[model samples]
Target: MNGANMSARLKDKIICITGAASGIGRATALLMAREGALVVATDLQADTGAALAGEITQTGGRAIFLQHDVTDEDGWREVIAIIRARHGRLDVLVNNAGIGLSGPVVEMSLADWRRQTAVNLDGVFLGVKHGLPLLRQSGGGSVVNVSSIAGIKASANAAGYCATKAAVRQFTKAVALECAAAKDNVRVNSIHPGIVETAIWDSLIGTTQGARGTRLEALTAPSIPLGRTGTVEEIAAGILWLASDESRYVTGTELVIDGGRSIA
Candidate 1:
């Protein structure tokens, strides 16, 4: 509803987010912390992740930074252990760690496919597998998987990325159904974002056409119906909604924040 009310929606919730070092993950971590959640931020970038946690703590928000490589099962085990030991419960998990491989399918290497899947798809699987018990113990929570517009529609020269994202979308739905059937109160869903002005976007398309311009103009803001690339804050807002009790009845759905690009 209003700012004060919306800001209080997630008060005191326990949220664990992957890829919290930069991009959408960073945004989500900060925003959720500001919303009064005890945020546990994790990513491969230890310094940056810890910096984000520091910023939150400086502002009097509860936060912890953990060095995490989402592809590592041992790392996931440690993450869960930390959550259990510290918060004693987990109310939300945002699976946001991902990488993009942009080559035509025929020209794509096995290594490229494996890398993308390992981080993008396998990471999501591990998050759900390990986070489920904590979420269940918490009497139910939400899981937000960050997919991509590529997951829904075919894109040129992005076969591996598309396939992994597509798998994430389906996996999210499947997990949602399972949780629903079990009456676990766990909500699992996916978010499909279009070209967002994040490091991930830059790394994926930085060398392509229009790469020399400012980040805003180069990445998007001109190619979509919305007339701009989605901002990390915008996407984080959607994530906050999904994590909060406001979305209590919502589950097993894909929320597309693509600026209507898919329609174009």
Candidate 2:
């Protein structure tokens, strides 16, 4: 089969991505649009998500922006209902909204723990809970959850964040098995990223050092084994593969895009 005809893999497929205001989520929206998916770019930042959707529209790609708070089950349900009503099916669901909470467990409060899990773990759970039916309606689609290298391994002073991300990894596996066992034609997977140069990283640095200039570069270049942090586009490409038919046999796998940091 011609690659064009055979692998317009996502042509006309509807994909919904959370956290689309910036970082990996934004990148995925653009990349998926380029690959012929009807992208729904959503985030709490209404302005940014709208701008991204507009850009895609200007480029002659189909897209919509929905304001979403991942922690709100009602919001997630609304999103799916609207998508189904408007677009008819949800082919790909990307759970990409997350926050970076840094502090030692001893100093971390219940609020901190809850906040992290609410967005990272519980948010993913909600997506799967609500999205599975839609994905099955598409005759089997991919669910890509954004995890972290921190999920696979622990870091110093990031107990709450690590715990939530770890939950996402395991949750993806468990859910993938559930889908397969039900033979529901829905695939679930996770992406584990290391120090990716995202707005989240900038915000984390701003919270700590009060300046993201040199500190950001140092974090990107020094610690990672590849001598550089991953890019949002790089991570988006991984998501595209998982969401596309090329990865049909690849469910429940964690695609780590951390510039080889996990190898070290």
Candidate 3:
């Protein structure tokens, strides 16, 4: 669609996105802002997050940035308070912050597992726990939790990552059911992205053997039916649908944005 003809799907909505400094989170932040949402972009990388918010403002969109550590309950409280004070209500929350720690289950340390769970699974719980009130105050909204394809399919070297993402998927369903039972208008869903072209791959597969680009292509070629990795923008598009009113009836579901990798 042309820029002028594009629908403002999230116009005037208040959206808070975690891990907004880079990758799918970054892409989502930009797209949501363009669609007229008041974007609050948060990430551990203060400089990059600030730059993203600044870019949105310079382009005539409304946005702000905050350094957020999603694992901290106190930090979440502060973030919600900021939204309440500034925007009065939150219309959407994207729990997109996550880490990928991979190793054989036998070789992985307890600390590693705990860290992965803390960010990927626990962070989503905290976001829903704290953000729900504001969403209700806004008269109901949506929550999009970013999981992974590993959540549905298992991988030998990524036991911890898979376990945490799987937990996120179930947690999303539980929250969706709870909201429905309570007669709340809020909807909850999870997005499982396959091999997206993001920097996370660098940490998942180290570059010692060859160039990072070559390693990434090799990693995705064998399994992905599309013969290539997905892009952050593609994943963000699904997230946007979940966050916007377009998916008003969708809840307690998993939106897989893989290149048919999970099926293959």
Candidate 4:
């Protein structure tokens, strides 16, 4: 089918995405809107988040920006409440907000670890804890948590990042089983992206090989079997599938878009 026909896959769906100011979240929000879903984009960054909403509106897509910090339980509550009040139903929750602190575990401070945990793992937890209710109320939907290849494959200096992402992976399966047993019609799944070309990589760039100004391509060349990094658009496409009915039978699974790095 053509792009127009394909774009209607999520027609009239209600989608709320966290960490949507930039990176994968931004791409997912834009893609979902094009698919005819009403996008509620949330992030801690007020300015860029609003700009994202404006960009979507200019393109004739429905979207709204909300300032949200995923680690705040009360904030999650309010975001979902507002969605319930205005839209009356929510079809998908994309817990895409996260951060990575690339360093040796010994040198990492407790506060830094906690901060990473709060966003990478706790954020996803809160999204499901609150978003699942509205999802069930909508008669069933999907929750797409953005995990990473670090979740499954071990790396040298990314212990904390891996820990949180791994937690998200396992948490997804547990919730998926719970939802299935209760027949709530909600599917929970995790997306494990390897090395995506996003802002997140900027911090990770100099951590390895002691090269402070090493290019991403140079770092990825010897590692990623596909000879390149993934893109936010590619990652967003996987997330879109999970959010759409096309993945109705898929849950409690990890959609790895890592270009063979995980296997390598």
Candidate 5:
């Protein structure tokens, strides 16, 4: 469908996305804005987040940037309060901020494991904890927690990352059930994205540019059944579906946007 003719699926919805400075988070924010949602893009990279917000605004979309550290409880409180004060309600919350700490379990330090858990798992918990009330106030909403394909499958060196993502999957279901039983109209679901072309890989591979492409291709050739890595936009599309009313009946489920990798 043409951009102009496409339906504004999330029209007027107030959406908050964490870790939106770049990667899947940034892509999702842009897509959500295109669908007519007012996006609050948050991240630790203040400059990059502001640039993303500017890009959206220049494209005639509504968006604002907030410097946030999802691991901090006070940061979440401030973000939700701002949302409540400015928009008075929140229609969607995308827990998209995360980190990658890869190494053999025995070789990994406790500090490294905890840091990864804090960003990937604890952050999502806090987002749901603080964002739920605004969603409930909105009369109904959706929560899209970005898990990883590793959540469903084990990787030899990614034990910590996999564990945290698995926790997100279960956490999503529990919250989904809680909202359902309360009849609060809030739906919760997790999105499992496989290898996507994003900055996250920089940490995983220990490089940001140059030889990164060769390393990525070498890494994905056999692992991803699609014979290629997924794109941020591809994952964002799934996220948009979950966040919009199009997936109103979907809750407590995992939307796997991998390149057929998890099954393989």
Candidate 6:
């Protein structure tokens, strides 16, 4: 390893993150790069994802951006194959791509529910199913699934979103146990972030504090025990620790970065 990499936490680690076009995914991609990982940042939004990859490289970090649709199985295959070809091994997989669909359960259409489920739950499933082998080939790795506070705590008008995230939470635990049982040395976990202002909110109707049409601050501040929304960088830091060797002994656990919203 180079002198700078010798002391880096994720030096030489081959890391892949989905939904890297914006929000938490973008923040994580940058953070992982800063820690010496070669980042594969994929997203459905090609332009933004490519920009993220470019930014990383221009700043002396290694990254590649691929246009990816998390709901497509073939996309997952192609992505994993590309990584295997380029790096020959996978060290970390961050299933951070998710969508937020709101409105009352009755008002939500079947199509909307399925779409939400496909992106939020199935995306994480496909990530684990496809990425696990390469991680195993690398001798061991970590999979960080980005769930939400909704997964831990329910709210009105977000039934579809909540259901999918909750599934991710339990699914993560089950997969973690499967890895442990097989003695593959792979660890799987989930992150539940509270009210952080991100692109997801652009489509998400604020359901907190009954302030449906209020500003983001008014909707989030009073409800959160910390009196503020969480930041994408804060969430990224937690993900970095889980991805690095620092959390070697942690698995099948949730690292909630929601600033006490889950408890409140």
Best by TM-score: 5
lDDT of 1 by residue, 181-218 (tens): 99999999999988876666555665543552366565
Tens-digit lDDT track of model 3 for 84-187: 99989999999999999877799999998899899999999999999999999899999999999999999989989999999999999999999999878999
Where is model 6 poorest over a 10-residue stretch in terms of lDDT?
Answer: 205-214
lDDT of 6: 0.91
lDDT against true structure, model 3: 0.92
In model 6, the Cα lDDT at residue 253 comes to 99
The residue-by-residue lDDT of candidate 4 on 148-251, one tens digit each, is 99999989889999999999999999999999999999999999998866777767764443342247767775798988878889999999999999998999
Off by over 4 Å in 4: 1-6, 206-214
Alpha-carbon TM-score of each model against the true structure? 0.93, 0.94, 0.96, 0.94, 0.97, 0.94
Q: Which digits, one per residue and each the tens of the lDDT, describe model 2 over residues 80-110?
A: 9999999999999999999988866889889
Q: What are the C-alpha RMSDs, in order, of all predicted structures?
A: 2.9, 3.2, 2.0, 3.0, 1.6, 3.4
**Which stretches of model 2 miss by more than 4 angstroms?**
1-7, 207-213
The lDDT per prediction is 0.89, 0.87, 0.92, 0.91, 0.93, 0.91
**Which pairs of residues have clashing backbones in candidate 1?**
221-228, 221-229
Give the per-residue lDDT digits (tens) of candidate 6, residues 209-255. 33533567787789888888888899999999999999999999999
How many residue pairs clash in all the candidates, one count each?
2, 1, 0, 0, 0, 1
Clashing pairs in 6: 194-258
Report the lDDT tens digits of candidate 5 across residue range 9-62. Answer: 999999999999999999999999998899999999999999999998887889
Clashing pairs in 4: none
**Is 1 or 6 the stronger prediction by TM-score?**
6
